[model samples]
Target: MDTMRDRFAPVVSRLLDEDPRVAVVLAEIGKDGFAEAMRRHPERVINVGIREQLLVGAAAGLALTGLRPIVHTFASFLVERPFEQVKLDFGHQNTGAVLVSAAASFDWPAGGYTHMAPGDVALLDTLDGWTVHVPGHPDEAETLLRRAVAAGDDKVYVRLSVQANRQGRAVDGERFLTVREGRSGVVVAVGPVLDAVLAATEGLDLTVLYATTVRPFDTAGLRRAVQGADTDVVLVEPYLTGTSTAAVSEALAEVPHRVLGLGVGRRELRRYGTVEEHVAAHGLDARSLRERIGGFVGAGRASVRA
Candidate 1:
């Protein structure tokens, strides 16, 4: 499968070159690939070393100056390192800066606990005036990025992973694609696990909601989706049980909701392994997810179906 870099490089490069008002801040590590793309455009790029704080601050400043800035960085550095800067500079001031957080969750293996961001969803959800999106595939990523760039809203964070399946381009306006539709229950998923959800519910009657937008959630659409469902909804994410789960619960207050968060638990780092290994260790793999869904289905039948 093509990497997220391969999928987004062309589109991002075009946007940088075409939009004179756009500026890109590439992380020190992301510089090689992103910089090469920007070099093609020449005058639309900026570098901020390895200082995540400075990167965010600069992007916030650029936004204030009427320039659209896209800040690229590792998910951990983006969320933990420059958190205060993001909160005060962008969140407080409401700057129209787009944050592209790569290697979200455990996508970057052997990076260890220091670089692992298993709580980004929870952290960003706490802040107001921020739109958080975690695209499940490359096509969704492109669409979401384009929409964020065109959107007037400030403080947008896109949590990206390197595992997107680049099968084909997303259909127009397919950002919020409905993987399944059912009047009984809803299962919302983000990140690479979307494919897992699809596979798990191959013959189930439950609705599967592919929510690309994590924060500033589509409350209206979500509420409508779960309006008549008999059983409580289930939210799946690549993080701990907090943001995505809590948001759905709050949004569908009248209706019940359950969250099945999958990520590295808060603890010391262990042995080194690949991204898939880490995800599997923490029950984030497709098979584990399928079992969880099976349990939910069984319970739902007992409570609602029967």
Candidate 2:
């Protein structure tokens, strides 16, 4: 099975072939994968060298011309580095572009803090009118990418990560899927963390809700899952901890509930290690998650910061 980034290039290549209105902009980060795409559609496939600002600015310029631009780069460079452009060029201008990001969180541990982007989703949350997609498997990534490209002049961000689940769920880029139905509590697994969440909550009577498109926050689905059930909710994401806790709170504002946000934490791990090592260090592995989730649900009041 290919990684999400591994599948992005060819998928966009096919999209370029199918849609004349679609365009791609890069900043020399993943240009090698699009060699064939560049050769085939030199005019549409753009590589703006190392200028992250130029990458987004160019894509916005393309969008101004009524073309749906798809921009790709590392999360740090794509969202953090050129955030001003993302705010102004896309958001302020009322122009929509599909911003696809790779290397979510600490996917590439050796790349150091500069390459990691655990705060990308949180930062984008400050802005309005942005649809965020975090796909756990390549199939889900492909589905979200296709939907983003097909979307007409809408600001969409599709987050791609190296970490993935063992299998892909049927994701429609809309609502959350109910993996398990229970009355104890609800665990919302976003992107790649479904398998670990499943392992952690094994034997526990809890509703495991899976999500691909997280920005919309599937309020109705979550309400239905917790209706007459345990009002306790837990969000296990692959990005910064508590990224979606606010959304969850707003979703259940009318009801009395408690939410525990779990994901990459604010503490920085300077040492460069393997991905698995980072997962363990951040307490995101199955063992740590099981302990934290069990404590939270059992005790009825516990704060587990990822």
TM-score of each: 0.89, 0.97
- Which 10 consecutive positions of candidate 2 have the poorest summed lDDT? 297-306
Best by lDDT: 2
Which candidate leads the pack in TM-score? 2
lDDT values of the candidates? 0.73, 0.93
lDDT of 2 by residue, 151-245 (tens): 89999999999899999988998999999988889999999999999999999989999999998889999999999688899999999999999
How close is each model in CA RMSD to the real structure?
2.6, 2.7
Clash pairs detected, candidate 1: none
lDDT of 2: 0.93
Q: Model 1 Cα displacement at 37 (Å)?
A: 5.6
